[model samples]
Target: MRFIDSHCHLDFDELADNLTKYMSDALASGITQFVVPGISLAQSKSLLAFSQKHPSCHISFGLHPYFLTAHSRDEMALLADLAEQNSEQLVAIGECGIDSQCDDLELQQALFKSHIVLANRLGLPMIVHHRQSHHLIAQAFKQTPPQFGGVIHAFSGSLQQAQYYLKLGFKLGLGGTITYPRAKKTREVVSRLPLSSFVLETDAPSMPVFGFQGQINVPVRLIDIFAQVCQLRNESEDEIAQALYATSCRVFSI
Candidate 1:
């Protein structure tokens, strides 16, 4: 029952403080690998350092839409330079994408495009963080798609949007959000989507599953997400686990 959390922010203060214990708990629950996504330049460095210490951890560096104020025009250039300098250590080029819910749509799109361009140029995958900006993100991908493809972390959209990303060579990242009964759209998409088009994630220290309300999420909770997905799709746990693991490896080239 080994599992991989395709997306998480383990560098956040909550998880970083007790990463050793968190990793131990995850291992105990059969979560072997985790992809730690960066939200900003400083977070990216912390993520890389964490990955260096933990063999099962992988790193993805980019700007998140929510942190629009922190990013400057030069940050994109700096990110490109960092990617080139640390290519050997970097696995992907995100937790980055557009967020329509925010006030700075223009800035979000600008940063999003920058990441896509860098990812395409470097032959690395992009880990997308889309929210209410699916169509815009899709359009960005159309303008400058990545050669290595990417994943849509914490996807909560319609089957049509899911199919669009699937066509664009991206895998959906399912997390604790789907376990909630109120996540009707997410549940529907998960139940209908082809198993190969998705990878499991936790988005740890956030997006905790239904049963663990108010508790900080960690990689260990991924098993709970796996079970929820299996129940929603009415598939065996082993079958779902196998498909998700293969999809993750394919997307991340692990």
Candidate 2:
């Protein structure tokens, strides 16, 4: 089956330790492409070197909300400059979004808005890192919609929430969460949402699949996630694979 892992952190310690091996494993599993998101200014800059080495891995640079302490007051300006300087080498403008559980929700929203504006200006899509702040995210999107559209990475929301993102031209990212038997809501959303409104992601070295919990996740687990998605949907494996590949390509224009 053809697949593209729309989100993966190949620069992270666990995966980057022996990236060549993991990359080989992913390629052998029929996964064609991988999108690596920027979690901070330093990490994003670090990714530049990785991109030069791995042409098959695409990059997107932005600050993640969870690491707000790593960001400075002029962080958005710096991120904008970095994004512009390496615009040609990047695919989207994320892993940025607000997480309600964090105390700095307001600050995260401000940064997210800046990210939205930057993405719109660059005509690039986004790889939004959403959590328990769907209303906040949807509100941000509704206020300043993304012109190139993006994916809600590691999506785990209701069908109504899923429809909201789909309506705004964004696609829901299906990851390891759906593999669990306890993910009934996410599974139900997967089973119900239109095939075109989704993309596959591993968020690797992070979101390990069901049986592999506590292990370092990798892009190859995308195949297992894809298998679960096929079971959740009515489409055949080939049909699901083709549609998901097309959606992944379209979302990032990679």
Candidate 3:
């Protein structure tokens, strides 16, 4: 079945330099679409250029928490402007959310809240990124729920957390994390969750699946991730593939 990588970093030089080749690889593997989230304003500029050139690539504009220090107030204003100016080109508002591992949870929260507001105002969804901060993200949502809920990028958590996001209208991104034997909880969550609540992603050049640890992840590996997902659930491979493709389209309005 055809698939969409809910998140990828094609703007990163490693992927962008050989984009045509990798896009070919992804297409060959049945992955026809990709969603690229913005981390830094600088990188986002390049992402926009790439999206313009490649019709299969979709994008969002927001700041990533890990690089919080680089995002100034002016940069944030500019981020909003970018989202607005490119509203026609954008599918979502992020790659932005809380990462408990990062310093200054308060700053991250503020920026994330701003992204939520920006997304709401722009009438688009968001691509949320989280690490050990489901509570924090849920808390943020309590304050202002997503007007158009989006995808939780690279989701790995308990069924409760997965349910929480799905209740708020977000889809959980199933990535290489599920390929690991050690990820029992997440795999179980995947098995138990509704088939429609899930979407596929590789988080390429990072989050390499099972046997390929330490190697750069690529879009083509979505097939392998899809394989692992099929093993976790009760659905047939073709059934799961159709459901995933349809749900991904619903998520990003693809």
How high is each candidate's TM-score? 0.95, 0.97, 0.97
lDDT of 2 by residue, 171-234 (tens): 9999999999999999999998789989999999999999999899988999999989989989
Q: Rate the local accuracy (lDDT) of all candidates.
A: 0.84, 0.89, 0.89
Instruction: List the RMSD of every prediction in angstroms.
Output: 1.4, 1.2, 1.1
Stretches > 4 Å off in candidate 1: none
Question: Tens digits of per-residue lDDT for model 1 on 1-254?
Answer: 78888888777888768988998998988888888888887777677678878879889889888776754567878878888888778779998988878777878888888898888877889898877888898787777766777898899988888898888788888998899899998799999888998899999889989989888888888988888888888778888898999889888878
The worst-scoring run of ten residues by lDDT in candidate 3 lies at 66-75
Total clashing pairs for each candidate: 0, 0, 0
Tell me the deviation in Å of residue 198 in model 2: 0.8
What tens digits encode model 3's per-residue C-alpha lDDT throughout 102-168? 9899989988989999999998888999999988998999998788999999999999988988888
Flag the better candidate by TM-score, 1 or 2: 2
Model 1 TM-score relative to the real fold: 0.95
CA displacement after TM-score superposition, residue 130 of candidate 2 (Å): 1.5
